[model samples]
Target: MSEPTTGPAGAAFDDFVAARSTALWRSAFLLTGDRHKAEDLLQAALVKTWRRWDRIGHGSSRSHETAEAYVRRALATTYTDWWRRRWRGELPTGELPERAGDVDEAARAEVRHDVLTALAALPRGQRAVLVLRYFDDLTEQQTADALGVSVGTVKSQASRAMTALRSSPALTDRFGDAA
Candidate 1:
């Protein structure tokens, strides 16, 4: 397929967006589990990226990997920020409370719902750390850089999250099967 050409800045930006937009939006949606929120998060990240496009391009990396790193980090932090606003109550949900639990693939869907709920219930820092460490496969230092926190913070967050997840019956049931 022929590529769309605009200008140096516009074309470069457009190409970057076109190539990465779908994956980034999907990642955002998976992280947030809300379509509207995902759209807002991705848009915000892209806008910030566009503002820094010139400076970012001036860096040494030709692959735009640094830009991708920035976008992922921004989106992750934004999701965590939005999640905190929704955590006003102190109630605990052991099983899945999701309304979208109905699925033709009942067994797996049940496990997935529980996992999502568990992830959502985790403290913002812990959840972000877990997702960065396990889901995104980023190292502690990378996760710390992404969240603008220290590596020690990442380690502590992961330690706490792992402890809680291990104590969680839902996760034990789900993950035990994997092991």
Candidate 2:
């Protein structure tokens, strides 16, 4: 389709981006496990979505859902493509410092760090599967659709992901002794 021009379609795309970019960024961050990469991933998805705005079921009764599905698919596929290309190479420096907030906030940040670190160890497909299935709360079919895989693939990926997470020493140590 032709690119969305600087008119009604462009305006609609702008409004959608303004309203949904933050949530999309969170999802991208979960998929990528990095702030800078997540920003780039979301930006690339937005650009692709803008290019296809007119044909993306814009302003339909379920416009929000349709647009999100399109952009999310772009995010997932592009992330996988990047993995195949080995675009990112550097390892994370360390767990981020907890923000100077309440005690509870500090604990939550630590837990989040542990979880994300553990997630980063899994293979790219398994990580994507878990993020889509559990984090995004998508159904098996929906997750499969988003990742461009079959339902069986989704199930297997989720099963393997959970097994890997269960065996992660860092994750177990973080919450294992708490209970």
Candidate 3:
């Protein structure tokens, strides 16, 4: 990983990342549904935010909040752009990987797999809205802002995404009526 930038802007940026990286990583993971992709997404977003740290008013009381919003926006836009230009050369196989020894871990992995499968089926916009509004716990307006969409668009996308997920075979098979 690259070293943190020096001086005031660097200090602020470093502090923001240190304090919020875990939560940000969760958002990224939910958005990408893959650990390596999530790490790349978060790193890309953080780099974008770092480039504008001074302009984002690093010394202000609300600097961290501003930086958070900027980073989230970056994450959403970058993911969408990547989706648009995605290379589909790689294909998934039907074979399942070996299970973990721990029963609890295996159950958690199953749930995660089901959820990721369901999420992967969503349209890019709907997936982004769902991740931002639900997983990241952002309000509809905040999600809209992050996505550069209107609040109504966020609401509709979220609703449609939820409806699709509720009907998804991956989730339905796992959770039955609850899904």
lDDT of 3 by residue, 1-179 (tens): 34447987788787888999999999999999887899999999988887777678677769888899999999999998887899968755443354668787778877888898899889989999999999889998999999999999998999999999999999999889789
The CA lDDT of each predicted structure is 0.75, 0.87, 0.87
Error of 1 at 45 (Å): 1.1
Error of 2 at 42 (Å): 0.4
TM-score, per-candidate, Cα-based: 0.74, 0.91, 0.91
* Model 2: residue 54 alpha-carbon error in angstroms: 1.5
Candidate 1 error regions (>4 Å): 1-6, 58-63, 83-104, 173-179
- Candidate 1 lDDT, tens digit per residue, 57-115? 72344646777888888888777776667756685445534446556566666877777
Compute the lDDT of residue 149 as modeled in candidate 1: 93
Better structure of 1 and 2 per TM-score: 2
